[model samples]
Target chain A: MLQSIVHVCLAGLSQGMFIWLVASGLTLIFGVLGVLNFAHGSFYMLGAYFCFMVLRALGENFWWGLLLGPVCVAAVGYLVERFFLRRVYGLELPYQLLLTFAFVLLFDDLVKIFWGAASIGTPPAPGLADSIMILGRRFPSYNLFVIAVGPLLALGLWGLLEKTWAGRIIRASSSDREMASALGVKVPTLFTAVFVFGTWLGALGGGLAVPYLGLLTPGMGEQIIIEAFVVAVIGGLGSLKGAFLGALVIGLLSAFGTRFLPTFDMFLTFILMAGVLLWRPQGFFGEAR
Target chain B: MSKKGMNRRQFVKAGLMTAAAAALGPAVLKPTSLWAAESKVKGPIKLGYQTVLSGTLAGYGEFHKMGAIMAMEEINTAGGIAGNKLEIEFRDSTLKAPDAIQNARYFVDSWGADFLAGIDSSGQALALAPVMAELDRVLMVTHAATEKLTEEQVFKNGVKQIFRIVTPTYQDGNAAAFVAKDLPVKTWATINPKYEYGFTCWNMFKETLSALKKDVTFTAESWAPFGTTDFRSHINTIMDAKPEGLYSVEWAGELITMVKQGIQAGLFNQVKHVMFPVGAAMDVLEGLGAEMPDNIWISGRYYFLYPNDKSNNDWVERFHKRWQHYPAYVSEGAYSTMYAFKKAVEAAGSKETKAVVGALEGMTLDSPAGKRVFRKEDHQAMYDVPWGLTVSNPKYPFKIMGKQVMVPAKDCFARPPFEGPGTKPPFKA
Candidate 1:
């Protein structure tokens, strides 16, 4: 029983990490840009498909694909922001949303044309393919990697945001965009950078996720996007710390939900999200105005 | 001598033709041009296939579309059904109920389809089943396998115009149980997608397992929502329980993900036996490719390469040639439904919906899956449900079912009499 709990925790952590990657990106973009990039999940999907194609053409070293996949995705993200998202700045939220939605369809069809309408597999990393002994039972090492990386990345992100000059510029602009512009900051460059950075986070999540989930089919982005939104909402839309917390809670809930509540497993995540929203409208960390 | 002989032969032939024409007189003079002038080309019959075409279960919808196209082309080449040609118009359901219902309306109202068919998700079927009753048109269901369309949940008076080509969930679940019992597995873990059909499969599989092996124990049960990309936790739970066998009712996207993740995590190596519902999805098999281990006990709605018979081979070969991929169960379902509709239409000799419905209630149609007859009692189509051990074939890209066994639909299925006149039928599980 102890062993099972430990295994479940590992599973939860892996799932939590995936959610964190996307939610963090969503949070950062929403915080700094004040624009909800609805197409954030599409970037994640591109990373995954990119990894699949590269690994298929190359070999099954998920780590190599994981490392290299994000570069191209980041480049695409930069282009998408420069060309498409730049127009939507200072515009209504719905316009930004609609444009992103169109992007969702565009990327979805592009994947279909390139990959065809079939599921493709991604093998687990070579060394991490084997399960590790934990709490007197075996658990997958790939999952352990995910568990360790989530918090490490969180700390790294924190250091980047709090301790660096570039981070200070981002924090200043997000807090008061008009004030940052008055202070002679390169406001437009900051916004573009934030959007591109958010997109990079999404792609990084997707690339890291490939080896564990192991298949890239069309519309997979849409499915994960909903869950990421739930995490973002529960964690407070623009709070990176809240995104991490929300991901953790959502992950554990999803993992244990399937085990204990078997029948209601499908609704558990949404039910939890609803409960959280009812209790805390601004999420766990957001200030009640 | 050779040149002179050839010249003599040519002259003799010309002389003979002139003599024969002269002897035949006016009869031979009749215009050979009349027959050539009378030849006329007819237009193709357009069929609108509305289905879940681009989501997690998109493969099923696409398979059905391909099957319909294959059947239409094959039939058209053989002079078509009653001298009319066939074409198909497709719409994507996105695996949503409202989308499917909307597509149904569009197919009938806007597309003006001669025939309409499709559905991969049973939820979509339940959503659109009422449209069949409302519209005075025949909607041949090819892939949606939920029993509700044919049995208990079917709208009052809806059964008349609706015909099912795919075996319902319970029927397919029963076959999985039957095959599992033959193995050494005695304890089981149930992991199915968290949905109506998945729940239905769990209940039916458990019930069937109980009946087959009364002493068998169920150790754990897990349900993941449709399109669940991660199965690590579910696998951990099931593995912890240490069930002798595992029953996974996941299909298409979820099934492929689970198999790849579960195998990598070493669940297959630990479990004594494994059986996945819809284990025959080509997307799952093709996705897994060489990584899918051999000898996992699995069953699906259709296996294109199963039958050794000539007719089955011919159809399979033709379908493969046309589609460039193995026909998943959805394609088989669509192909079978179209043929059933064709037979019904011919028998009724009218495009009138009621007449076709009457003909279909007790119809038996020859399909690529062999002879399948709809049971008049429940409107559930009956045919051989093939279950097999998954084996990787060097000749093919994906794992194909080998050591196959066909359990005749009648042998495994019991179309219990409908709970008549207001008493609710027992909800499965």
Candidate 2:
């Protein structure tokens, strides 16, 4: 029983890490731009597809994909923000929402056109395909890598935000856009930069998750986007820390729920989200408006 | 006397009537000659094909499309169907029930489709069944495998227009159970998608397998929503249960993910027999490629390389030559559906919907999967379900099943009409 519990916790942690990776980017984009990028998940899908293509073209060197895939997606994100999203920045929330949603459809169809709507899988990286015995329970090495990377990323992001000048400007712009512009912060450029970075994070998550997921489909983004949204809403729409907490909560609930209440497992996360909303309508970390 | 009152107009009409009767005298005497002339110049037979054509399951839909198209081309090449060419109007259902129903309506109302076929999801088929009855059109279901679509929902509701070409969930489960009894595994666990198809499949497997292997026991069970990408938590739970075998109802992308994750988590190493009733599909094998582990048991509605009979092998060879890939079960199903429609139309001696339905009730035809017969009582086709063990074949790029076991149609099913106890009790809403 103890061993099983440990295994479940480890599984939850790995899942939570992936969820955090996706939700953090979503929350960040919403926080800075005040536009919920519905196409954020499409970027993640593009990352996976790009990574798979790169890996195949480069003789299955998974490392090359890990590095270059996100760069490609980030470049696309830059173009999108510069051309399309920029026009909607000054418009009402619904216009921005509609534009992003349109991107989602556009990207989905583009993937179908290129990838042929078939699901394809990428093998795990060399040396990470196997499992290791931890505390007498077999756990996948790739999962452990994911779990380790998540906290390190969180720490790095924390350091950048708290200790860097660029991070300070970003924070200032997010909190007081008009004041930041008045103080000569170049708020527009900062918003674009934040959007690019957030998109890069989303794509990076996708690339990281591909080996574990082992399959890519055109509709993959649509499946995960809802979960990311749930996490963002439960954690407070714009709070990175809250995104992490919310992801972990949902992930653990998923793990334990499948074991105890197999029939109602899907509803467990929604139930938790509802409970949190009832207690704290603004979310645990959202600023009171 | 009339001529005294009539002018030149009456005289002209009389002369024209005499000329018309002289010209049409032979055709009026023998109406069969006129009908024969019209038959030679008959209009094309139009079929409306709808399925999930643009989503994750699009691969399945694509195969169905290819099969239907190939059948149409082949039929046209062979002087068309009774000298009338077959044409198909394709639509993407988007894997939604409402969209499927709407598309069915659009096909009949707007396109004047002679018949309707193609539904990849069971829920979509069931939703469209009543719509078919409402439209008074015959719907040949090619891929959806829910037993309730035939036995309970369509049966109890008296929807005779819905005919299933592919085997249902119970048939597949019962077939897999035959293979399971011969295996040495004593304990098993199940992981399936949470839906009508999944539940029915698992229940059928359990009921059949338990009956055969009385000593065997089920240790754990897990259900995930359809289209779920992640299965790590479920894998861990099943692993903890430590069952000797695992039966999974996951298919397509979901199955690929689970198998890959299971390998990574060493779940396969622990479980002795990992069986997937629908995992032997070409899409699954091709998606996983070399990543698919050898010796795992998988089954499908059809196997491209099976039956080893000359005719079936020739058909498969032609399919590969035309499509440049192996045909999945749905491909065969859709292909056979077109031929079945042609045969039924010929038997009915007319293109009327009711006549075709009557002709199709007890229709039998030879297919790539061998002979198939549509049960007159329930409108479900009876054909062999193939299951086999995965092996790495040098001739194929992906893992192909070896030690093939083709469960006979009679063995996989109960007596016809399927009016037995309900497979699943209706929801008390």
Using lDDT as the measure, the top candidate is 2
Against the hidden true structure, what lDDT does model 2 obtain? Answer: 0.84
DockQ of each: 0.41, 0.54
Looking at candidate 1, what is the lDDT of residue B199? 81
Q: Candidate 2: list runs displaced more than 4 Å.
A: B1-41, B420-429
Q: How do the residues B1-429 of candidate 1 rate in per-residue lDDT, one tens digit apiece?
A: 566899689667645654654476347424432332244322344567877767555556667778887777777788776466767788887878877766776676556565678777788877776676655467777777777677754434444667677777755577777777777888888777777888887777877778777788888888786678888878887887889899887877777778877876678878968887677777778878888878877677777776668988888787788878877878788777667766765676644555566777778888888878877766777777678888877899888888877666765665555444322212232
What's the distance in Å from true for residue A29, model 1?
A: 0.6
Task: Give lDDT tens digits, candidate 2, residues B1-429.
Answer: 445557467546545654664476456635543354345334599899998877678777888988999999999999777779999999998988978976887787658788999988888987887668767679999888888788765557778898998887855578878788899988989888898888888888888888777898988888989877778778877887889889988999999999888887778778979889888788999999998898999888888887779988888889899988888888999999999988988876666666778889889988888889998777889888678889998998899888877667766665545645532222122
Question: Residue by residue across A1-289, what tens digits does model 2's lDDT show?
Answer: 8877788888888888888888889999999889999999999899889888888889898878989999999999999999999988888988898899999989988998998877877878777877899777678888899999988888888888879999898888889999999999987788889999999999988899888898888868877778889999998999888888888888888888877788788899999889878988768788766
Q: Clash number for model 1?
A: 2
> Stretches of candidate 1 above 4 Å error?
A263-268, A287-289, B1-44, B153-158, B416-429
State the lDDT of candidate 1 residue by residue for A176-246, as single tens digits. 98999999999988888888788888988888878777777777788778888999999998889999999
